[model samples]
Target chain A: MAVLNMVSALNQAFGGEMERDPSVVVLGEDVGRDGGVFRVTEGLLDRFGADRVVDTPLAEMAIAGMAVGMALNGLRPVAEIQFMGFSYLTLSTMISHASRMRNRTRSGMHVPMVMRMPYGAGVKALEHHSESMEALFVQVPGLKVVVPSTPREAKGLLISSIRDPDPVVFLEPTRSYRLMKEEVEEESFTIPLGEARQVREGDDITVVGWGAMMPLIEKAVGSVGKKGIECDVLDLRTLSPMDSTAVLSSVRKTGRCVIVQEAPRNCGVAAELIARINEGALLSLEAPVERVTAPDIVVPLPQGEGHYYITPGRIENAIERVANF
Target chain B: MLIDDYDPLKKRMLQVLDQEGKVVNPSLEPVLDPDVLMRAYRTMVLARQIDDKAVILQRQGRLGAYPPNRGQEAASLGPAMAIGKDDWLVWAFRELAGLLWKGLDPLRLYLYWMGNEEGSHYPPGLKVLPAVIPVGSQLPIAVGMAYASMIRREGTVTLSYCGDGATSAGDFHEALNSAGTFRTPNVFVIQNNQWAISMPRNRQTAAPTLAQKAVAYGFPGIMVDGNDVLAMYMATQEAVGRARRGEGPTLIEAYTYRMGNHTTSDDAKKYRLEEELKEWEKRDPLVRLKAYLMNRGMLDERQEETILGEAKEETERIVVEAERFPRPTVDDVFKHTYAQMPRTLTEQLERCRRLEGGGR
Candidate 1:
C-alpha cells in the first residue's frame, strides 16, 4: 500500500491501465508534456510514447467528438476536458454522440472512454473553472456519472471507468485533489461503478454525500456523534446508477436522513437521491429528509462565496435536527 | 475533379462537362467506363425520383419530414461511388443518395426518417457511421478515425459529407484544424447547396468561397460543378487516393443548389423566387449526365425510359419493405445505453413495463 493523494492515485490509474491495456491512450490539452493542469495525468507521456499520449488542440468540441471516433476505431481513449466549466462546450458532443453511440448504433459501436475533469468550486479559482455541473451529465440517458472522494476511491473508480464498455463521466473534485492523503493499493484494483461505501456506522440517522462534500460530511457526522447524535455516512461513489438500495436500507434503519452537496438546491444530485429514497422507503422515514445545498445562484467570486459553500456547520446542524426530529 | 489553382479572395468554379454536354478538358480527361458512367447516371436519376416521391409522401402524411437532395445529386452520388468498400462514409442528413450508392438499403434510410432506431443500425464491418443530424458535428469524429488509421498504418481513408451550412459551425472549424494539424487522411465533401434552410450562402459567411477556407487548414481546396456527377466522382477519387497515400486532406466544395424545399417541413417558395428555381432546373444534373450518355451512344431513349422505370419500381418495393418493418421495441430506449443495464436504468425499464402491461 502507498500513502498517496488523489492526483498521484489518478496518475497510477492511468499508468496501470495503459500498461495493462495497450489500446488505452490519453488525449487532452497539455496532458502530454505538462502532465495536466492539475498534474493528475503526470508521467503518462513518459511511460507511453507520443503516439499513445496525444496533445490535442485547444478545442473542447473536437476533443470530445474525437474520442467517439477513436473509440469507434477500436481504441480505448481517456479524454480530459481541462476543467469542469470548460466542459460545457463539450456537452453537445458528449450528449449527442459519445453517450448515444452504443444506443444509436445498437451495439454496433460504443465509446469505451473516460471524460475526467476537475469539478466543483473551491480554492478561489477563476470563472468557468469552478462549475459543479454533475446534474447535467447525469441527465443524459447513456452517460454514467462517477464521483470519487478519496485517493483509494479515485484510483479504483478511475480504473473501472476506463475498463467500462460505455462512456463514463468521471468528475474529479478540484477541492479534493490534494486535500487529503489515504492508503491506496500499489497493485491493480477497481471499485465497482454503481456501488456505495459505508464510511461510518451509526443508528440515529444517515448522512449521505459525495465528491468534495464527502469529507466535510464525514467530519460533520463525527462532530454530531460526540454531541449525542450518532450518524451513518454513506459516500455515494457513483451518482447515476446510484446505490439506491444501500441508501434506502440506511434510511430504513435510521429513520432519518440528511444530504449534503456542493451544487445548487434545485435539480441537484441531492434532489434526485431524496426522490429515489422516498419512492422506495418513504414509510420507513420517521422524519422529513433534510437537504443542505448551496443556494440556487451563480457561485460568486471567492469574496462573496462564503455564503454559498456547504460547510461542516451546515451539515452538522442538518443532521442534528433530522436525528432529533 | 479538375485540380487547378484556388485563390481564396477570388473564388473559382470548375466544370468539365458543360450544360450542353461538352468536355472542358479533354487532354487531362479521366476515361470513363460506360457501365460505370451509366451506373452513376442511374443513381442520380433514382435519387431525384426518391426526393420527388418523399415530397408527395410527406404531403399525404404517410411519412415524417424528409430532406430532399433534388438538385444536389451529383454533389452526393459522385463522391459516394469514388471510394472503396474498405473506406468509411461519415454522413450528414443530406447524404442519403451517397449512402444508397454505397450499398445501404433504401428501406433502412426510410426507416430512420420514419423515426425507427433499427433503421439507423449499419450491420457489422460496413465501416459506415450512422447519419449525424447536428451540423458539422461529425467532422472531428471523422478526423479521429483517420488519426487512428495513421497510427496503426491501416491506410483506411475517410470521406465525410456535410452541407454548406455546416461550414459555419464551430465543430466543423475544429475538425478541419485538427485534420490539418495532424495531416489526417480524410476528405471533406462540402455540398454548397446555396441555402442553409433560409439563410443564403452570402449570409452564411463573409468568405467568398467555402473551398477557400481549407487553405487556412493547410489543405488544397477545389470548387466543382456539383450537378456534374462526373466532376464530383473525379474530385472524390483524387482526394481519396491522396488521403490513402498520407498526402493529407482536401476540401471539395461542390457548388450545387437545393431545387426542392429544404425539408418536407420547409417551404423554399416563401424565400426564393420561381425564376431562380427555373434557372437551376435548366442545369439539372441528371439531364446533363443523360445527354452525355446518349451522345456517347451508351444510352438511347428506350434505355433511358427503362432505367427510370426500374428506378421507380425499386423505390416502391423499398417503400413496401420499409412500411412492413415492425415497430421498434421500447427496450431500444434502454438497451445499448450500457453494456449491462445499470440499476437506475433497470428501474426505469421496470416502471415502463408496469405502465404498458410489459413489452419486449
Candidate 2:
C-alpha cells in the first residue's frame, strides 16, 4: 500500500495503464510538458514520450471527436477536459454520436474511451472552474458516468473506466483532489461500476451522496450519531449506473432516506434516486426521500458558494427531518 | 508505358473500351482478369436488384422508407469494385450498392431500409463503416481512420463516399484539409448525381465543379462520366493505387444524373423539370452496359431477359430472409453502448424493462 493523494493517485493510474498497454494514450491541453495544470499527469510525458502523452490544442470538440475516431480504429484514448465546465463544447460529439454510436449502429461497434475532468466547487476557484454536472451526462445514452470521492477509489475506478468497452465520463472531485491522503493498492485493480460503498452503517436513517459530497455526508452521519441518531451512509461510486440495489437496500433497512449532492436540486441524480425509491420500494414504509442539494442556480464563486451550497450541517438537518417524518 | 502516365484530372476521362463496345485504346486498356470483371458485373447487378426491391417493398408497406440508388449504381459499384476487400469504406445513405460491392449482405440491406438499426452492423474485419445518415459526417471519421493507419504504418487506404451536397459541409473541408496536411492514404469520391433531394446542383455549390474543390486541399481532382462504369472504375483504380503507394489522397467527381426520385418518400416533380429527367434516362448505366454487352456479342436479348428475371428472384429471396430475422429488442439498442452495461445504463434498462412488463 502507498499513501497517495487524489492527484498523485491519478498520476500513478495513468502511468500504470500506459506501462501496461502501449496503446493507452493521454491527450489534452498542457498534459505533456507541463504535466497538467494539477500535475495529475506529472512525469507521464517524460516516461511515455510525447506521442502517447499528447499536448493537444485548446479544442475540446476536436479532442473528444478525434478520440472517438481513435477508439473506433484501435487506440484506447484517455482524454482530459481540464474542468467539468469545459465539457459543454465536447458534449455534442459525446452525447449525439459517442453515446448513440453503438445503439445507432445496432451493436456493430463501440467507442472504448474515457474522459477525465475535475468537477465540483468548494476550493475557492474562479468562475466555470468548478461545476457538478454529472446528471447531464446521465441523461445521454451509451455513455457511463463515474464520480469517485477518495484517492484509493479514484485510481481503481479510473483504471476500470479506461478498460470499459464503451465511452465513460469520469468526474474527479476538484475540491478533494489534494484535500486528503489515503493508502491505496500498489497493483492496479478495478472497482466495478454501478456498485456503491457503504461508508457507515446505522439503523435510524440512510444518507446517500457521491463525489465531493461523500465526505460531507460521512461527517454529517458522525455528527448525527453523536446526537444519539444512528444514520447509514452510502457513497455512490458510480452516478450513471447508480447502485440502486445498495441505495434501496439501505433505504429499506432504515425506513428513511436523504440524498445529497453538490449540483442543483431539480433534475439532478438526487431526483432520480427519489423516483426510483418510490417506484421500487414503495412498500418499505418510509417517508418521502428528502434531497439535500444546491439550489437551482449556477455554481457561484467561492465567496457566495458557502452561502448557497449544502454543508454537513445542512445534510444533518435533512437527516433529522427525514427521520422525524 | 504511357498507361502509368495518365492522370484522371489532367487527361481526358480515359475510356479504353469505347461506348460502342470496341477497344478504342487497346494499349491503354487495363488487363482486368476475367474473374475481376465478372465480379464487377455481379456487384453492379446486385446493387440494382437491391434498389428495385427496396422501391417495391416501400410501395407494398414492407419497408418504412428507402433512399433508392436506381440511377447511381455505376457511380457506387465502379469505385467500390476497384478497391481491395481489406481497404476501408465510409458511405453515405444512398450507397448500398457500394456496400454490396464490398460484400455487404442483401439481408442486412433489406433490414436497414426496413428501419432496423441492426442492419448497419458490419461484421468485424470487413473495414466498412456503418452508413452515415448525417450526410458528410463520415468524412472526418474516415480521415481520422486514415491518419491512424498512416501512423501505424498499416499500408491501408480509406475511401470516403458522399454526394455533391456533402461538399458544402464544414466536416468535408476539415476532413480533406487534415488528410492533405498529414498526407494520409484516403480517396474522397463525390458522386455528383446532379440533385440533392429537391435542391439542384447549381443551388448547392458555386464552384464550377466538385472535383475542383480538391485542388484547395492540395490534391488532384478528376471529373468522370458517372454513367460510364468503365471510366469510373479506371479512375478509381488509379486513385486507389496512388493512395496505397503513399501518394496521399485524391478527390473524384463522378458526374452523373439522378434518374429516380431522391428517395421513396420524395416527390421529384415538385423540383425538377420532366425534360431534364428524360435527358438523364437516356444516359442510364444499365442501358449503356446492356448495349455494350450486346455489341460485344457477350449478351443477347434472351440472356438479358434471363438476367433480369434471376435478379428479381434473388431480391425476393433476400427480402423474405431479412424480414424473418427477429425484430431488434429495446435492450439490443442499449447493448454494445459499452462492452458491458455501465451502472447508469443498467438502471435505465431496468426501468425500461419494468415499464414494458419485464419482457426485454
Candidate 3:
C-alpha cells in the first residue's frame, strides 16, 4: 500500500493495466512527452515507449474518435480530453459511434475504450477548464459513466473502466486530484462499476453524491452529526448504471433523502437520482428529496465561481431541511 | 509515384481511361488480373442494379430512405478492390459499390435501409464498418485503426471514404491531421460527388482541390478521374502499397459527380441543371468500364446482357431475403446494449415485457 493522491492513483492504474495488457495504450495531446497538462501521465512515455504512450495532435474529436478505432481494432485505448468543457467536441463520436458501436453492430463489435477528462470547479482555472457536466454523458445510452471520489476509488474504478467491455466516460474530479491523500493499493485492484460505496452510515437522512461532491457531503454530514441529525452518505462511484439499489435501500431506511451535485440544477444527475428514489422508495419517504446544486447558469469564471460553486454549507442546509421535514 | 505525378496542388488529375473508354494515359493504366477485372466489373454492375432497385423499392414503400450510388460506382469499387482482404474499410454511407466489393451481403445493405439494426451485424471476417450517416465521422476512426495497426506492427491499412461535403466537416480535418501526425497507414478517399444535398463543390471550400487538403496535413494527396476505374484502381493500389510499406497515409480525391439525388428524399432537379446531369451521364463509370472491357474483347454484348440479368435476379432475391428477415425482438433491443446487461437494463427490459402483455 502507498499514500497517493487521485492523480497518482489514476496513473498507477494506467501503469498497472498497461503492464498487464500489451493491448493497452495511452493517447492524447501532451500525454507522451509533457506527461499530460496535469502531469498525471508523467513518466509513462519513458516507461512504455512512444508506441504505447502516444501524444496526439490537439484535437478532442479525433482523440475520442481515434480511441474508438483503436478499441475496434483490439486495443484498449485510454484517451484524455484536456478538460470537460473541451469534451463536447468528442460528443460527436461518443454519441454517434463509440456509445452505439456494440448496439449498432448487435455484438459484432464493441469499443473497449476509456475517455478520461478532469471535471468540476474549485481551483481558480481558466475558462472551459472547470465543468461538472456528468449529466450530459449520463444521458447518452450505451455509455458507462464513472466518477471516483478518493485515491482508492480512483485507482480501482479506473482499472475496472479500462477492463470494461464497452466504452466508458471516466470523469475525474479536478479539484480532488491532489486535495487529499489516502493509502491506496499499489497493486491492481478493481471496484466494480455500478456499485455504490457507503461512506458514513446513519439513520436520520440519506445523503447521496459523487466525485468532488463527496468530501463536501462528508463534511456536511460531520457538521450535522453534532446536532443529532445522523446521515447515511452514499458515494455514487458510477453515474450511468448508478447503484440505485444502495440509494433506495438507504432511503427506505432513512425515509428522507438529500442529493448533492456540482452541476447546474436543471436536468442534472441529482434530478435523475430523485426520480429513481421516487420510483423505488417513494412510499418509504418521510420527507421530500432536497437537491443541492449549482444554479442553472454558465459556470462562472474563476473570479465569480464562489457564488456558483456548490459548498458544504449548501449540502448541510439540504441535509438539515430533509432531516427536519 | 502516382501521387507525385498528379500533384493536387498542380490541379493535375490522373486519368487512365477517358470518358469515351479510350486509354487516355496508357502508361498509367493498371494491368489487372482477368478474374479481378471481371469481379470488379460484376460488383459495379450489381451495385448499379441494386441502387436502381433500392430507389424503386423506396418509391413503392417497401424500403426506407436510401442513398443512390448511380454514377460513382467506380470511385467506390476501385479503391475497395485495391485493398487486401485483411485491410479495413471504414466507409461513409452511399458506398454500396465499395461495400459490395469488400464482401458485404447485399441483403444487409437492403435491411439497413429498411430500418433494421441487424443489418449492421456483419458476418465475421468482413472487415467493413457499418454505414456512417454522419459525414466525415468515420475518418478519425479509420485513423485510429491505422494507428493501432502501426502499434501492433500489423501491415494492414485502413481505407475510409467520405463525400465532397464531408470535407467541410471539422472531423475530416482532424482525422487527416492526426493520420498525418501519426504517419499511420491510412488511405483517405474523398468521393467528390459534387453535391452535398444542394450545396455545390465550389461553395464547400475555397481550396482549388479537395485532394490538396492532404498537403496541409503533411501527406501526399492526388486527384483521380473517378469515372475511370483504371485510374482510381492504379492510384489506390499505389497508395495502399505505400501504406503497407510504412510510407504513411495518402489522400485521393475521386473527382466524380453525383449522377442521382443525394438520397431518395432529395430531388436533383431542384438545384442542379439538366445539362450538368446529362454531361455527367456521358462519363458514367459503368459505361466507361463496360466500354473499356468491350473494346478489349473481354466482354461482349451477350455477356453484358447475361451479367445484367444475373444482377437483376440476385437483387430480386436479396429484396425478398431482406424483407423476410426477422423483426427485432424486445430482447434484441436490450441484449446488445452491454456485454453483460446491468441490473437496471434487465429491470427495464422486464418492464417493457410486462407492458407488452408478456409476463415472461
Candidate 4:
C-alpha cells in the first residue's frame, strides 16, 4: 500500500484506468500540459498522449455535451467540470440527454461516462470555487451521485464509476482533497457504489455524515465518547443510492439518530435521511431524529463560514440533544 | 380512377398498375426480379396489416395511442429497399413500414404499441433506432452518426425519414446545417403526406416545395410522386448512391397523401373534403405498382391472390404472438433506467414494492 493524497490518488487512478482501457479519455480545461487547475491530472498528457488526454476549451457545455455524444459512440469519457459552481451550466445537457437516453430510447442506448467536479467550502478559494451543490443532482431520477471523503475511497469509487455502464456525477470535496490522506493500492480496483462505510461502531447513538463533514463527525464522536455516550459513526460515501438499511439498522439499535451534511438544512440530504428514518423506524425511535446542517443560505466567506456551516462543536451539541432526549 | 388528359406531373404521378401488374419508373428504370418484387409486396402488405391492427387495438383499449401510416406504405418501403440492410435508418412516428424493410419483428412493434419499452429493442447490428416522438430530434443524431462515420472513414451512410411538419422545427435546421458544412454521408427523406394532423401542408410552410428547402443547405432536392412506388424507389436509390459516393446529403420530398384519419382518434371527415379523398383514391400506390407489373407481363390475378393470402396469414400469426407476449413487471419499469439503476429510484422502487407486498 502507498500513502497518497487525493490529487496523487486521482492521478494514479486515471493512469491505471487509461492503461487498462484505451477507450478511456480525459477532457477538461488545462488538464493537459497544466495537469488541471488543481494538478489532479498531472503528467497524464505525457503518459497517454494529447489525443486521449485532451486539453479542451474553457467551455463547460462543450466539455460535457461533447462527452455525451462521444459516449454515445462507444467511448468512455471522463470530463472535468473544474468546480461545482461551473458545473451548473452542464445540468441541462445532462438531464435532457445523458440521464434520459436509456428511458427515452426504451433501453436502446446507454451513456457510459462520468462528470468529475471538485466542490466544498473552507478552502479559502475564489468565488465559485467552493460550493456544496450535490443536492441539486439528488433530485434527478437517472443520475448516480458519489462523494468520496478519503483518498482511498476517491480512487476506488472513481474507477468504479468510470467502469460502470451508466452516467455518474462524482463530487470530490475539495476541502478534504489534501486534508484527508490514506494508503491506497497501486493496482487498479473499484469500490461498489450505493454502499456506506462504517467509520466507527457504538451502541448509545448513531451519527450519519458524508463528504466534507466526515472529519468533523469523527471529532464530535471522540468528544461525545468522553461524556460516556457510545455513538455509531457512518460515512455515507454514496448519496444517490443512500445505504438506508445500514442507517435504519444503526438508528434502531441506538434508538436515536443525528444526521450531518454541508448543504443547507431545509432540503438537504439530511432532511431526506430524517424522513426515511421517521417513516421506517418510527417505533424504534426514542425521539425525533436531529439534523446538524448548514442553514438555508449561500455558503459564506471563510471568516464567517463557521457559523453558517456545520462544525464539530455543533455536531457534538446535536448529538447530546438526541442522547439526552 | 380518373383516366383522362391531365398535366404531365399529374399524369406521371397518378399511376395504377402498368399494363401488366409490376411497378415501373421512367427516369431510372430498375430491373425488379421475382424475388425482390415479392419481398417488396410482402413488406407493403405486412406494413398495412400492422397499421390496421394497431389502430383497432388502440380503439379496443389494448394498445397505447399511436400515429398511423395508412396510405404512405410505398413512401417508407420504397426507400427502405434502396439501402443495404446494415445501413442506419432513423425514423419519426409515421414510418412503420420502414421497420418491416429493416427486418424488425412485427410482434415487437405491436408490443411497443402495447406500452412496453422493450418494443424498441432491435437485434444487435441492426442499425435502426427507436421511433422518435419529438419530431425532428433524430435528424441531428443521424447527422452526428454520419459525421462519426466520416471521421472513422467508414463507408456507412445514415438515412433520416420524417414528415412535412418536422421541417418547421429548429432541430431540422441544425441537422441540415451540420450536414451541409460537413458534407456527411446522409439522405433526408420527407414523407409529405399533405396534412400534419388537421393542419395542411400550406399551414406548415410557405415554401413552394419541401424538397426545394434543401438547396439552401447546399444539397440537391427532388420531389417524387410518393404514391408512385417506382418513382420513389428510383429517386431514393439515386440520392443514396450519391451519398455513398461522398457527394453529400440530398433531400427527397415524396409527395403522397393520407388516405385515412391521422390515427384512430382522428376524424378526417371533420377537416377534409369527401371529394379530396376520392381524388387521391385514383392514385393508390399499390394499384399503380400492380398495374406496372401487369403491363410488363410479370404478374396475374392468381399471383396477386396468392400473395395477399400469404400476407394475411403471416399477419394473423404475428398478431397472435404479440397478444400472447407476457406483460412487463412494475420492477421492470424501474430496471434499465440507467446502465444501472440510480440509488434514488431504487429507494422509490423499494417503497412501492413494500406497499405492494413485494410483487412484480
Which candidate leads in lDDT? 3
For every prediction, compared with the true complex, DockQ reads: 0.78, 0.38, 0.88, 0.20
Q: Write the per-residue lDDT of candidate 4 for residues A235-288, one digit (tens) a residue.
A: 889887778888998998999999998887778898889888987898999978
User: Which model scores highest in TM-score?
Assistant: 3
Candidate 1: tens digits of C-alpha lDDT, residues B123-205: 88888899899889999999888887878888878899899899999999999999998889899999999999998999989
Clashing pairs in 1: none
> Which DockQ-derived CAPRI band holds candidate 2?
acceptable
Query: Ten residues in a row with the worst lDDT in model 4 chain A?
Result: A57-66
Show where candidate 4 strays beyond 4 Å: A1-12, A25-74, A77-111, A115-143, A172-186, A200-205, A212-231, A262-268, A292-317, B1-27, B30-34, B134-154, B162-262, B266-297, B300-302, B329-360
Q: Chain B, model 4, TM-score against the native?
A: 0.91
- Model 1, total clashes: 0
- Chain B alone vs. reference chain B, TM-score for every model: 0.96, 0.92, 0.98, 0.91
Per-candidate iRMS values, in order, are 1.0, 2.5, 0.6, 4.1
How well does each candidate reproduce the native contacts, as fnat?
0.76, 0.46, 0.83, 0.25
Model 2, position B76, has a per-residue lDDT of 86
lDDT of each: 0.87, 0.81, 0.93, 0.80
**RMSD in angstroms, candidate 4?**
6.5
**Candidate 3 lDDT, A192-222, residue by residue in tens:** 9999999988999999999999999888889
Tell me the TM-score of model 3: 0.99
* Winner on lDDT (2 vs 3): 3
Give the range of the ten consecutive residues with the poorest summed lDDT in model 2 chain B: B1-10
